[model samples]
Target: MKKCTIIGKTNVGKTLFLINFAGYLGLKFLDISLCDDKKILKKYKLSINQAIYELVNDQTHKTRCLQSIIVDVPMGKGKKKLQLIDTVGLIDGIHSNIEIRKAISHTLTIVRVSDIILHIVDAASAGRDELPSSMGEVDYQLAQFAQLKRGYAILANKMDLPDAKEGLDKIKSEFSGNLIIPISALHKKGFKEVRTFVAHNI
Candidate 1:
Protein backbone atom coordinates (compact mmCIF):
# COMPACT_ATOMS: atom_id res chain seq x y z
CA MET A 1 0.00 0.00 0.00
CA LYS A 2 1.07 3.56 -0.61
CA LYS A 3 1.84 5.73 2.42
CA CYS A 4 0.48 9.24 2.81
CA THR A 5 2.17 11.05 5.67
CA ILE A 6 0.62 14.10 7.38
CA ILE A 7 3.26 16.52 8.65
CA GLY A 8 3.23 19.99 10.18
CA LYS A 9 4.60 22.04 13.05
CA THR A 10 3.53 21.43 16.64
CA ASN A 11 -0.16 21.95 17.53
CA VAL A 12 -1.00 22.54 13.90
CA GLY A 13 -3.93 20.06 13.87
CA LYS A 14 -2.12 17.13 12.26
CA THR A 15 -3.61 14.58 14.67
CA LEU A 16 -7.11 16.01 14.41
CA PHE A 17 -6.89 16.02 10.64
CA LEU A 18 -5.81 12.40 10.61
CA ILE A 19 -8.58 11.17 12.88
CA ASN A 20 -11.29 13.35 11.38
CA PHE A 21 -10.23 12.54 7.85
CA ALA A 22 -10.43 8.85 8.63
CA GLY A 23 -13.87 9.37 10.09
CA TYR A 24 -14.86 11.23 6.95
CA LEU A 25 -13.72 8.25 4.96
CA GLY A 26 -16.34 6.13 6.80
CA LEU A 27 -14.35 4.73 9.66
CA LYS A 28 -16.55 4.53 12.71
CA PHE A 29 -13.83 2.87 14.74
CA LEU A 30 -10.14 3.50 14.47
CA ASP A 31 -7.59 0.71 14.58
CA ILE A 32 -4.49 2.80 14.98
CA SER A 33 -0.96 1.49 14.81
CA LEU A 34 1.47 3.49 16.88
CA CYS A 35 5.26 3.32 16.57
CA ASP A 36 7.50 5.01 19.08
CA ASP A 37 11.00 6.31 18.72
CA LYS A 38 12.33 2.99 20.00
CA LYS A 39 10.44 1.24 17.17
CA ILE A 40 8.05 -0.55 19.52
CA LEU A 41 4.64 -1.00 17.90
CA LYS A 42 1.27 -1.06 19.60
CA LYS A 43 -2.31 -1.11 18.39
CA TYR A 44 -5.50 0.35 19.78
CA LYS A 45 -9.14 0.20 18.77
CA LEU A 46 -10.93 3.44 19.53
CA SER A 47 -14.30 4.94 18.87
CA ILE A 48 -14.30 8.17 16.93
CA ASN A 49 -15.12 10.25 19.99
CA GLN A 50 -12.68 8.37 22.18
CA ALA A 51 -9.86 8.86 19.72
CA ILE A 52 -10.59 12.58 19.52
CA TYR A 53 -10.73 12.92 23.29
CA GLU A 54 -7.58 10.95 23.98
CA LEU A 55 -5.47 11.85 20.96
CA VAL A 56 -6.33 15.40 19.98
CA ASN A 57 -4.93 18.02 22.32
CA ASP A 58 -4.43 21.75 22.53
CA GLN A 59 -0.93 21.24 23.84
CA THR A 60 2.08 21.01 21.58
CA HIS A 61 3.72 17.72 20.68
CA LYS A 62 0.84 15.68 22.09
CA THR A 63 1.79 12.97 19.65
CA ARG A 64 5.24 11.71 20.57
CA CYS A 65 5.21 8.93 17.98
CA LEU A 66 3.87 7.88 14.60
CA GLN A 67 0.21 6.88 14.44
CA SER A 68 -1.07 5.30 11.25
CA ILE A 69 -4.28 3.82 9.85
CA ILE A 70 -5.07 1.84 6.76
CA VAL A 71 -7.78 3.50 4.70
CA ASP A 72 -9.49 2.63 1.46
CA VAL A 73 -10.21 5.49 -0.91
CA PRO A 74 -12.76 5.14 -3.65
CA MET A 75 -11.14 4.68 -7.03
CA GLY A 76 -13.50 4.27 -9.99
CA LYS A 77 -15.87 1.51 -8.90
CA GLY A 78 -13.46 -0.02 -6.39
CA LYS A 79 -11.28 1.16 -3.52
CA LYS A 80 -7.55 1.55 -3.11
CA LYS A 81 -5.76 0.87 0.15
CA LEU A 82 -3.48 3.56 1.47
CA GLN A 83 -1.62 3.98 4.71
CA LEU A 84 -2.40 7.30 6.36
CA ILE A 85 0.42 8.15 8.73
CA ASP A 86 0.19 10.89 11.33
CA THR A 87 3.63 11.90 12.46
CA VAL A 88 5.08 13.72 15.44
CA GLY A 89 4.88 17.43 14.87
CA LEU A 90 8.00 19.21 13.70
CA ILE A 91 9.57 22.29 15.32
CA ASP A 92 11.82 25.08 14.11
CA GLY A 93 14.76 24.32 16.42
CA ILE A 94 16.27 21.35 18.18
CA HIS A 95 14.08 20.14 21.00
CA SER A 96 15.43 20.11 24.52
CA ASN A 97 13.78 16.80 25.28
CA ILE A 98 15.62 13.76 24.00
CA GLU A 99 12.44 11.72 23.46
CA ILE A 100 10.85 14.39 21.29
CA ARG A 101 14.09 14.76 19.37
CA LYS A 102 14.09 11.05 18.66
CA ALA A 103 10.46 11.16 17.59
CA ILE A 104 11.21 14.01 15.21
CA SER A 105 14.07 12.03 13.74
CA HIS A 106 11.74 9.11 13.18
CA THR A 107 9.18 11.34 11.49
CA LEU A 108 11.82 12.58 9.05
CA THR A 109 12.75 9.02 8.19
CA ILE A 110 9.11 8.28 7.35
CA VAL A 111 8.96 11.39 5.17
CA ARG A 112 11.88 10.18 3.05
CA VAL A 113 10.05 6.96 2.16
CA SER A 114 6.45 8.19 2.05
CA ASP A 115 4.59 7.82 -1.24
CA ILE A 116 2.53 10.96 -0.61
CA ILE A 117 3.08 14.04 1.50
CA LEU A 118 0.14 16.01 2.97
CA HIS A 119 1.64 19.09 4.51
CA ILE A 120 -0.81 20.76 6.92
CA VAL A 121 -0.49 24.38 7.86
CA ASP A 122 -2.65 26.06 10.48
CA ALA A 123 -4.40 28.87 8.67
CA ALA A 124 -5.47 30.48 11.93
CA SER A 125 -1.83 30.93 12.88
CA ALA A 126 -0.28 31.40 9.49
CA GLY A 127 -0.04 35.21 9.42
CA ARG A 128 0.51 35.50 13.12
CA ASP A 129 3.78 35.72 15.01
CA GLU A 130 5.04 33.44 17.80
CA LEU A 131 2.38 30.75 17.32
CA PRO A 132 3.09 27.05 17.06
CA SER A 133 1.25 26.75 13.75
CA SER A 134 2.59 29.90 12.20
CA MET A 135 4.18 29.38 8.80
CA GLY A 136 7.91 29.03 9.32
CA GLU A 137 11.10 27.95 7.69
CA VAL A 138 10.37 24.28 8.30
CA ASP A 139 7.11 24.46 6.28
CA TYR A 140 8.86 26.17 3.39
CA GLN A 141 11.61 23.59 3.41
CA LEU A 142 9.13 20.70 3.52
CA ALA A 143 7.23 22.10 0.53
CA GLN A 144 10.45 22.47 -1.39
CA PHE A 145 11.53 18.91 -0.60
CA ALA A 146 8.14 17.27 -1.14
CA GLN A 147 7.55 19.05 -4.44
CA LEU A 148 9.80 16.45 -6.01
CA LYS A 149 7.09 13.89 -5.34
CA ARG A 150 4.07 13.42 -7.62
CA GLY A 151 1.68 13.31 -4.68
CA TYR A 152 2.12 16.45 -2.63
CA ALA A 153 -0.47 19.00 -1.51
CA ILE A 154 -0.82 21.61 1.18
CA LEU A 155 -3.89 21.58 3.42
CA ALA A 156 -4.49 24.94 5.06
CA ASN A 157 -6.44 23.71 8.03
CA LYS A 158 -8.68 25.44 10.61
CA MET A 159 -10.76 27.44 8.17
CA ASP A 160 -13.54 27.54 10.73
CA LEU A 161 -11.73 30.11 12.79
CA PRO A 162 -12.34 33.86 12.39
CA ASP A 163 -8.83 34.81 11.34
CA ALA A 164 -8.27 31.74 9.24
CA LYS A 165 -9.54 33.33 6.02
CA GLU A 166 -6.90 36.01 6.22
CA GLY A 167 -4.29 33.42 6.96
CA LEU A 168 -5.48 31.32 4.05
CA ASP A 169 -5.13 34.30 1.74
CA LYS A 170 -1.61 34.81 2.99
CA ILE A 171 -0.81 31.18 2.42
CA LYS A 172 -2.19 31.34 -1.13
CA SER A 173 -0.03 34.33 -1.88
CA GLU A 174 3.04 32.69 -0.43
CA PHE A 175 2.54 29.28 -1.99
CA SER A 176 1.51 30.47 -5.42
CA GLY A 177 2.31 27.42 -7.55
CA ASN A 178 1.33 24.59 -5.24
CA LEU A 179 -1.95 22.74 -4.80
CA ILE A 180 -3.54 24.13 -1.62
CA ILE A 181 -6.91 23.12 -0.25
CA PRO A 182 -8.43 25.26 2.48
CA ILE A 183 -10.11 22.97 4.94
CA SER A 184 -11.58 22.85 8.39
CA ALA A 185 -10.55 19.55 9.87
CA LEU A 186 -12.87 20.21 12.80
CA HIS A 187 -15.87 20.62 10.51
CA LYS A 188 -14.74 18.32 7.67
CA LYS A 189 -15.14 21.08 5.10
CA GLY A 190 -13.30 20.95 1.80
CA PHE A 191 -12.56 17.26 2.22
CA LYS A 192 -13.88 16.27 -1.19
CA GLU A 193 -11.17 18.28 -2.90
CA VAL A 194 -8.58 16.64 -0.73
CA ARG A 195 -9.94 13.21 -1.55
CA THR A 196 -9.94 14.04 -5.22
CA PHE A 197 -6.33 15.18 -5.09
CA VAL A 198 -5.32 12.03 -3.25
CA ALA A 199 -7.25 9.84 -5.66
CA HIS A 200 -5.76 11.46 -8.73
CA ASN A 201 -2.23 11.09 -7.42
CA ILE A 202 -2.66 7.60 -6.06
Candidate 2:
Protein backbone atom coordinates (compact mmCIF):
# COMPACT_ATOMS: atom_id res chain seq x y z
CA MET A 1 0.00 0.00 0.00
CA LYS A 2 1.10 3.58 -0.66
CA LYS A 3 0.87 5.72 2.45
CA CYS A 4 0.06 9.35 1.64
CA THR A 5 -1.44 12.50 3.15
CA ILE A 6 -3.51 15.19 1.40
CA ILE A 7 -2.57 18.50 3.02
CA GLY A 8 -3.69 22.10 2.46
CA LYS A 9 -5.04 25.04 4.40
CA THR A 10 -8.80 25.51 4.97
CA ASN A 11 -11.15 25.83 2.01
CA VAL A 12 -8.45 24.76 -0.36
CA GLY A 13 -10.57 21.82 -1.41
CA LYS A 14 -8.54 19.22 0.46
CA THR A 15 -11.58 17.24 1.55
CA LEU A 16 -13.34 17.88 -1.73
CA PHE A 17 -10.42 16.43 -3.64
CA LEU A 18 -10.32 13.42 -1.34
CA ILE A 19 -14.02 12.81 -1.74
CA ASN A 20 -13.69 12.89 -5.48
CA PHE A 21 -10.78 10.51 -5.26
CA ALA A 22 -12.87 8.22 -3.06
CA GLY A 23 -15.63 8.36 -5.61
CA TYR A 24 -13.08 7.51 -8.27
CA LEU A 25 -12.15 4.58 -6.04
CA GLY A 26 -15.83 3.67 -5.70
CA LEU A 27 -16.34 4.26 -1.95
CA LYS A 28 -19.95 4.07 -0.95
CA PHE A 29 -21.31 6.76 1.39
CA LEU A 30 -22.51 4.69 4.30
CA ASP A 31 -24.75 6.17 6.96
CA ILE A 32 -22.18 5.05 9.53
CA SER A 33 -21.18 8.62 10.29
CA LEU A 34 -19.49 8.86 13.65
CA CYS A 35 -18.21 11.95 15.42
CA ASP A 36 -14.88 12.34 17.16
CA ASP A 37 -14.72 9.34 19.51
CA LYS A 38 -18.30 8.67 18.47
CA LYS A 39 -19.38 11.38 20.90
CA ILE A 40 -21.61 13.22 18.48
CA LEU A 41 -23.39 10.00 17.73
CA LYS A 42 -24.16 9.43 21.41
CA LYS A 43 -24.53 13.07 22.42
CA TYR A 44 -26.81 14.03 19.60
CA LYS A 45 -28.32 10.56 19.78
CA LEU A 46 -28.48 10.53 16.04
CA SER A 47 -30.58 7.82 14.51
CA ILE A 48 -29.80 6.02 11.25
CA ASN A 49 -32.33 8.15 9.47
CA GLN A 50 -30.76 11.27 10.84
CA ALA A 51 -27.30 10.12 9.79
CA ILE A 52 -28.65 9.40 6.33
CA TYR A 53 -30.03 12.88 5.99
CA GLU A 54 -27.14 14.67 7.65
CA LEU A 55 -24.12 12.83 6.23
CA VAL A 56 -25.67 10.81 3.44
CA ASN A 57 -27.90 13.19 1.54
CA ASP A 58 -25.25 15.80 2.09
CA GLN A 59 -22.86 15.57 -0.88
CA THR A 60 -20.81 18.43 0.52
CA HIS A 61 -19.44 16.19 3.29
CA LYS A 62 -16.28 16.17 1.23
CA THR A 63 -16.36 19.95 0.93
CA ARG A 64 -15.61 20.33 4.60
CA CYS A 65 -12.08 21.67 5.11
CA LEU A 66 -11.15 20.11 8.43
CA GLN A 67 -13.59 17.94 10.32
CA SER A 68 -11.70 14.70 10.64
CA ILE A 69 -9.01 12.61 9.10
CA ILE A 70 -10.74 10.18 6.78
CA VAL A 71 -8.65 7.02 6.63
CA ASP A 72 -8.40 4.10 4.22
CA VAL A 73 -10.18 6.27 1.68
CA PRO A 74 -10.62 4.46 -1.62
CA MET A 75 -9.22 6.00 -4.84
CA GLY A 76 -10.52 3.42 -7.37
CA LYS A 77 -7.09 2.05 -8.17
CA GLY A 78 -8.04 -1.60 -7.88
CA LYS A 79 -6.74 -3.88 -5.11
CA LYS A 80 -3.52 -1.91 -4.89
CA LYS A 81 -4.96 0.71 -2.55
CA LEU A 82 -3.37 3.92 -1.43
CA GLN A 83 -3.69 5.34 2.07
CA LEU A 84 -5.36 8.75 1.73
CA ILE A 85 -5.75 11.20 4.63
CA ASP A 86 -7.49 14.59 4.59
CA THR A 87 -5.78 17.04 6.89
CA VAL A 88 -7.15 20.26 8.44
CA GLY A 89 -6.58 23.75 7.11
CA LEU A 90 -3.57 25.51 8.59
CA ILE A 91 -4.08 29.02 9.84
CA ASP A 92 -1.43 31.63 9.09
CA GLY A 93 -1.02 32.44 12.77
CA ILE A 94 0.36 30.32 15.58
CA HIS A 95 -3.16 29.72 16.79
CA SER A 96 -4.31 26.89 14.56
CA ASN A 97 -7.77 25.42 14.44
CA ILE A 98 -8.44 22.49 16.74
CA GLU A 99 -8.90 20.24 13.74
CA ILE A 100 -5.79 21.62 12.02
CA ARG A 101 -3.74 21.25 15.18
CA LYS A 102 -4.86 17.66 15.39
CA ALA A 103 -3.98 17.23 11.72
CA ILE A 104 -0.51 18.68 12.20
CA SER A 105 0.28 16.16 14.91
CA HIS A 106 -1.54 13.35 13.20
CA THR A 107 0.02 14.37 9.90
CA LEU A 108 3.46 14.09 11.41
CA THR A 109 2.63 10.51 12.18
CA ILE A 110 1.23 10.03 8.71
CA VAL A 111 4.21 11.69 7.02
CA ARG A 112 6.74 9.67 8.99
CA VAL A 113 4.90 6.47 8.14
CA SER A 114 3.87 7.41 4.63
CA ASP A 115 5.72 7.37 1.34
CA ILE A 116 4.32 10.58 -0.17
CA ILE A 117 2.60 13.86 0.67
CA LEU A 118 0.10 15.39 -1.71
CA HIS A 119 0.18 19.09 -0.79
CA ILE A 120 -2.54 21.12 -2.46
CA VAL A 121 -2.70 24.92 -2.48
CA ASP A 122 -5.36 27.37 -3.52
CA ALA A 123 -3.58 28.95 -6.45
CA ALA A 124 -6.60 30.99 -7.34
CA SER A 125 -6.64 32.51 -3.89
CA ALA A 126 -2.95 32.84 -3.13
CA GLY A 127 -1.92 34.19 -6.51
CA ARG A 128 1.59 34.24 -7.97
CA ASP A 129 2.75 37.46 -6.33
CA GLU A 130 3.07 36.30 -2.72
CA LEU A 131 2.02 33.38 -0.60
CA PRO A 132 -1.20 33.87 1.35
CA SER A 133 -1.48 33.32 5.07
CA SER A 134 -3.93 33.94 7.83
CA MET A 135 -1.64 36.62 9.27
CA GLY A 136 -1.43 38.27 5.84
CA GLU A 137 2.19 37.36 5.44
CA VAL A 138 4.19 34.58 3.83
CA ASP A 139 2.13 31.42 4.02
CA TYR A 140 3.20 29.67 7.17
CA GLN A 141 1.58 26.42 6.14
CA LEU A 142 3.54 26.33 2.89
CA ALA A 143 6.73 27.05 4.78
CA GLN A 144 5.94 24.26 7.21
CA PHE A 145 5.32 21.72 4.47
CA ALA A 146 8.31 22.88 2.46
CA GLN A 147 10.47 21.89 5.42
CA LEU A 148 9.36 18.28 5.12
CA LYS A 149 12.05 16.12 3.48
CA ARG A 150 9.74 13.65 1.80
CA GLY A 151 8.30 12.68 -1.54
CA TYR A 152 5.70 15.34 -2.17
CA ALA A 153 3.82 17.01 -5.00
CA ILE A 154 2.02 20.33 -5.32
CA LEU A 155 -1.40 20.75 -6.83
CA ALA A 156 -2.25 24.37 -7.63
CA ASN A 157 -6.01 24.07 -7.47
CA LYS A 158 -8.70 26.32 -9.02
CA MET A 159 -6.92 26.70 -12.31
CA ASP A 160 -10.26 27.21 -14.04
CA LEU A 161 -10.54 30.54 -12.33
CA PRO A 162 -8.91 33.57 -13.88
CA ASP A 163 -5.55 34.89 -12.66
CA ALA A 164 -4.79 31.31 -11.55
CA LYS A 165 -2.44 30.69 -14.44
CA GLU A 166 -0.14 33.38 -13.14
CA GLY A 167 -0.16 31.71 -9.75
CA LEU A 168 0.54 28.40 -11.43
CA ASP A 169 3.51 29.95 -13.15
CA LYS A 170 4.76 31.32 -9.88
CA ILE A 171 4.54 27.88 -8.28
CA LYS A 172 6.28 26.23 -11.22
CA SER A 173 9.06 28.78 -11.36
CA GLU A 174 9.41 28.78 -7.60
CA PHE A 175 9.41 25.03 -7.07
CA SER A 176 11.39 24.17 -10.24
CA GLY A 177 10.65 20.45 -10.35
CA ASN A 178 8.14 17.87 -11.46
CA LEU A 179 6.40 18.65 -8.21
CA ILE A 180 3.87 21.42 -8.88
CA ILE A 181 0.82 20.56 -10.96
CA PRO A 182 -2.08 22.80 -12.06
CA ILE A 183 -5.50 21.45 -11.28
CA SER A 184 -9.11 22.37 -10.58
CA ALA A 185 -10.85 19.89 -8.31
CA LEU A 186 -14.15 21.70 -8.69
CA HIS A 187 -14.08 21.30 -12.45
CA LYS A 188 -12.56 17.83 -12.35
CA LYS A 189 -9.86 19.20 -14.60
CA GLY A 190 -6.29 17.91 -14.44
CA PHE A 191 -7.63 15.08 -12.29
CA LYS A 192 -6.24 12.41 -14.61
CA GLU A 193 -2.78 13.88 -14.38
CA VAL A 194 -3.04 14.28 -10.66
CA ARG A 195 -4.15 10.68 -10.24
CA THR A 196 -1.50 9.40 -12.60
CA PHE A 197 1.24 11.28 -10.80
CA VAL A 198 0.19 10.01 -7.40
CA ALA A 199 -0.06 6.50 -8.82
CA HIS A 200 3.54 6.73 -9.95
CA ASN A 201 5.04 9.01 -7.28
CA ILE A 202 3.78 6.91 -4.40
Candidate 3:
Protein backbone atom coordinates (compact mmCIF):
# COMPACT_ATOMS: atom_id res chain seq x y z
CA MET A 1 0.00 0.00 0.00
CA LYS A 2 1.07 3.57 -0.55
CA LYS A 3 2.22 5.21 2.68
CA CYS A 4 1.21 8.84 3.10
CA THR A 5 2.78 10.28 6.22
CA ILE A 6 1.32 13.31 8.03
CA ILE A 7 4.19 15.39 9.47
CA GLY A 8 4.38 18.77 11.20
CA LYS A 9 5.32 20.53 14.39
CA THR A 10 3.68 19.67 17.67
CA ASN A 11 0.09 20.84 18.35
CA VAL A 12 -0.43 21.61 14.67
CA GLY A 13 -3.55 19.36 14.44
CA LYS A 14 -1.88 16.41 12.69
CA THR A 15 -3.67 13.86 14.87
CA LEU A 16 -7.02 15.56 14.50
CA PHE A 17 -6.53 15.71 10.73
CA LEU A 18 -5.69 12.02 10.59
CA ILE A 19 -8.80 10.98 12.53
CA ASN A 20 -11.18 13.43 10.91
CA PHE A 21 -9.85 12.73 7.44
CA ALA A 22 -10.55 9.05 7.98
CA GLY A 23 -14.06 9.94 9.08
CA TYR A 24 -14.46 12.15 6.04
CA LEU A 25 -13.55 9.13 3.91
CA GLY A 26 -16.59 7.32 5.46
CA LEU A 27 -14.94 5.45 8.29
CA LYS A 28 -16.86 5.28 11.56
CA PHE A 29 -14.52 2.85 13.31
CA LEU A 30 -10.75 2.88 12.79
CA ASP A 31 -8.19 0.12 13.10
CA ILE A 32 -5.06 2.01 14.06
CA SER A 33 -1.54 0.64 14.25
CA LEU A 34 0.89 2.39 16.57
CA CYS A 35 4.67 1.91 16.52
CA ASP A 36 6.75 3.00 19.47
CA ASP A 37 10.32 4.29 19.55
CA LYS A 38 11.62 0.78 20.19
CA LYS A 39 9.85 -0.31 16.98
CA ILE A 40 7.17 -2.25 18.81
CA LEU A 41 3.86 -2.19 17.00
CA LYS A 42 0.38 -2.49 18.52
CA LYS A 43 -3.07 -2.29 16.99
CA TYR A 44 -6.34 -0.97 18.35
CA LYS A 45 -9.93 -0.57 17.24
CA LEU A 46 -11.86 2.58 18.15
CA SER A 47 -14.72 4.70 17.03
CA ILE A 48 -14.05 8.12 15.55
CA ASN A 49 -15.05 9.95 18.72
CA GLN A 50 -13.09 7.63 20.92
CA ALA A 51 -9.90 8.03 18.90
CA ILE A 52 -10.24 11.79 18.97
CA TYR A 53 -10.69 11.87 22.73
CA GLU A 54 -7.92 9.42 23.46
CA LEU A 55 -5.32 10.63 20.96
CA VAL A 56 -5.79 14.30 20.24
CA ASN A 57 -4.27 16.72 22.73
CA ASP A 58 -3.12 20.33 23.19
CA GLN A 59 0.25 19.47 24.70
CA THR A 60 3.44 18.93 22.74
CA HIS A 61 4.52 15.40 21.74
CA LYS A 62 1.09 13.99 22.54
CA THR A 63 1.71 11.54 19.71
CA ARG A 64 4.94 9.89 20.79
CA CYS A 65 4.80 7.07 18.25
CA LEU A 66 3.83 6.36 14.67
CA GLN A 67 0.09 5.70 14.28
CA SER A 68 -1.28 4.58 10.95
CA ILE A 69 -4.58 3.51 9.35
CA ILE A 70 -5.49 2.10 5.98
CA VAL A 71 -8.24 3.85 4.01
CA ASP A 72 -9.41 3.42 0.45
CA VAL A 73 -9.73 6.44 -1.79
CA PRO A 74 -12.24 6.25 -4.59
CA MET A 75 -10.77 6.49 -8.04
CA GLY A 76 -12.62 6.66 -11.36
CA LYS A 77 -14.08 3.15 -11.26
CA GLY A 78 -12.34 1.51 -8.30
CA LYS A 79 -10.71 2.33 -4.95
CA LYS A 80 -7.05 2.70 -4.11
CA LYS A 81 -5.75 1.66 -0.71
CA LEU A 82 -3.28 3.86 1.12
CA GLN A 83 -1.85 3.92 4.60
CA LEU A 84 -2.40 7.22 6.36
CA ILE A 85 0.44 7.37 8.85
CA ASP A 86 0.31 9.95 11.63
CA THR A 87 3.75 10.64 12.97
CA VAL A 88 5.24 12.18 16.10
CA GLY A 89 5.28 15.94 15.74
CA LEU A 90 8.65 17.39 14.74
CA ILE A 91 10.21 20.24 16.68
CA ASP A 92 12.89 22.76 15.73
CA GLY A 93 15.45 21.93 18.40
CA ILE A 94 16.39 18.94 20.46
CA HIS A 95 13.75 17.75 22.88
CA SER A 96 14.48 17.38 26.58
CA ASN A 97 13.01 13.89 26.78
CA ILE A 98 15.17 11.13 25.35
CA GLU A 99 12.19 9.03 24.39
CA ILE A 100 10.66 11.92 22.49
CA ARG A 101 13.94 12.47 20.70
CA LYS A 102 13.91 8.83 19.69
CA ALA A 103 10.37 9.15 18.44
CA ILE A 104 11.30 12.20 16.44
CA SER A 105 14.18 10.28 14.91
CA HIS A 106 11.78 7.52 13.94
CA THR A 107 9.47 10.09 12.36
CA LEU A 108 12.31 11.37 10.22
CA THR A 109 13.08 7.85 9.09
CA ILE A 110 9.47 7.35 8.08
CA VAL A 111 9.47 10.61 6.17
CA ARG A 112 12.41 9.44 4.11
CA VAL A 113 10.66 6.22 3.06
CA SER A 114 7.01 7.27 2.70
CA ASP A 115 5.41 7.43 -0.71
CA ILE A 116 3.42 10.60 0.01
CA ILE A 117 4.11 13.49 2.34
CA LEU A 118 1.31 15.64 3.78
CA HIS A 119 3.18 18.46 5.49
CA ILE A 120 0.72 20.26 7.79
CA VAL A 121 1.36 23.75 9.11
CA ASP A 122 -0.74 25.65 11.62
CA ALA A 123 -2.05 28.58 9.60
CA ALA A 124 -3.51 30.38 12.61
CA SER A 125 -0.21 30.22 14.42
CA ALA A 126 1.74 31.12 11.32
CA GLY A 127 0.12 34.55 11.35
CA ARG A 128 1.59 35.23 14.77
CA ASP A 129 5.03 35.10 16.28
CA GLU A 130 6.49 32.93 19.04
CA LEU A 131 3.91 30.15 18.69
CA PRO A 132 5.15 26.58 18.61
CA SER A 133 3.71 25.86 15.17
CA SER A 134 4.60 29.21 13.71
CA MET A 135 6.56 29.29 10.46
CA GLY A 136 10.09 28.27 11.33
CA GLU A 137 13.37 26.95 9.96
CA VAL A 138 12.29 23.34 10.24
CA ASP A 139 9.23 23.90 8.07
CA TYR A 140 11.31 25.57 5.43
CA GLN A 141 13.79 22.72 5.47
CA LEU A 142 11.06 20.10 5.23
CA ALA A 143 9.48 21.92 2.29
CA GLN A 144 12.84 22.03 0.55
CA PHE A 145 13.41 18.31 1.06
CA ALA A 146 9.91 17.10 0.28
CA GLN A 147 9.52 19.21 -2.83
CA LEU A 148 11.96 16.93 -4.57
CA LYS A 149 9.42 14.11 -4.32
CA ARG A 150 6.44 13.61 -6.64
CA GLY A 151 3.84 13.15 -3.90
CA TYR A 152 4.44 16.17 -1.70
CA ALA A 153 1.95 18.88 -0.73
CA ILE A 154 1.40 21.35 2.05
CA LEU A 155 -1.77 21.39 4.15
CA ALA A 156 -2.41 24.78 5.70
CA ASN A 157 -4.42 23.53 8.64
CA LYS A 158 -6.76 25.43 11.00
CA MET A 159 -8.26 27.53 8.21
CA ASP A 160 -11.50 27.73 10.16
CA LEU A 161 -9.82 29.84 12.83
CA PRO A 162 -9.68 33.62 12.73
CA ASP A 163 -6.45 35.10 11.26
CA ALA A 164 -5.82 31.87 9.42
CA LYS A 165 -6.40 33.61 6.12
CA GLU A 166 -3.47 35.91 6.73
CA GLY A 167 -1.44 32.92 7.75
CA LEU A 168 -2.37 31.08 4.60
CA ASP A 169 -1.35 34.05 2.52
CA LYS A 170 1.98 34.16 4.26
CA ILE A 171 2.44 30.46 3.69
CA LYS A 172 1.64 30.89 0.01
CA SER A 173 4.24 33.57 -0.30
CA GLU A 174 6.81 31.48 1.49
CA PHE A 175 6.04 28.28 -0.39
CA SER A 176 5.59 29.85 -3.79
CA GLY A 177 6.13 26.77 -5.96
CA ASN A 178 4.49 24.12 -3.80
CA LEU A 179 0.88 22.91 -3.74
CA ILE A 180 -1.01 23.96 -0.63
CA ILE A 181 -4.55 23.02 0.39
CA PRO A 182 -6.22 25.02 3.14
CA ILE A 183 -8.13 22.79 5.50
CA SER A 184 -9.91 22.73 8.85
CA ALA A 185 -9.53 19.31 10.34
CA LEU A 186 -12.01 19.92 13.15
CA HIS A 187 -14.82 21.07 10.86
CA LYS A 188 -13.93 18.69 8.01
CA LYS A 189 -13.65 21.59 5.59
CA GLY A 190 -11.47 21.48 2.47
CA PHE A 191 -11.26 17.73 2.64
CA LYS A 192 -12.27 17.27 -0.96
CA GLU A 193 -9.17 19.05 -2.16
CA VAL A 194 -7.02 16.96 0.11
CA ARG A 195 -8.67 13.79 -1.10
CA THR A 196 -8.12 14.75 -4.70
CA PHE A 197 -4.47 15.46 -4.06
CA VAL A 198 -4.02 12.12 -2.32
CA ALA A 199 -5.86 10.22 -4.98
CA HIS A 200 -3.86 11.78 -7.77
CA ASN A 201 -0.57 11.12 -6.03
CA ILE A 202 -1.38 7.56 -5.03
**Backbone steric clashes in candidate 3, count:** 0
| C-alpha RMSD in Å of predicted model 1 compared with the true structure | 1.3
Residue pairs with backbone overlap in model 3: none
* TM-score, model 2 to reference: 0.66
Give the alpha carbon lDDT tens digit for every residue of 1-202 in model 2.
6656666655566766665655554555522222232132322333323433443221222223223322343245554556565555554555434654554555445555556677777786666333441112323445355547456778888788777877777666666654677887666777777677666655
Indicate whether candidate 1 or candidate 3 has the larger lDDT: 3
For model 2, what is the error of residue 5's alpha carbon versus the real structure, in angstroms, after optimal superposition? Answer: 0.5
Q: Roughly what TM-score does model 1 have, to 2 decimal places?
A: 0.96
Q: Is candidate 2 or 3 superior in TM-score?
A: 3
- TM values, all candidates: 0.96, 0.66, 0.97
lDDT (tens digit, per residue) of candidate 3 on 1-202: 9889999999999999999999999899999998853454898999999999999989988998899999999998999999999999888888899989988999889899888999999999997754788878889999999999999999999998888999999999999999999999999999999999999999
Best by TM-score: 3
Task: Tell me how many clashing residue pairs each candidate has.
Answer: 0, 3, 0
Instruction: State each model's CA lDDT, in order.
Output: 0.90, 0.55, 0.92
Residue-wise C-alpha lDDT for candidate 1, range 1-202, written one tens digit per residue:
8989999999989999989999988999999999853454999899889999999989999999999998899999999998999999898889999999999999998998888899999998985654767998898989999989999999999999878888999989988899999999999999999999888877
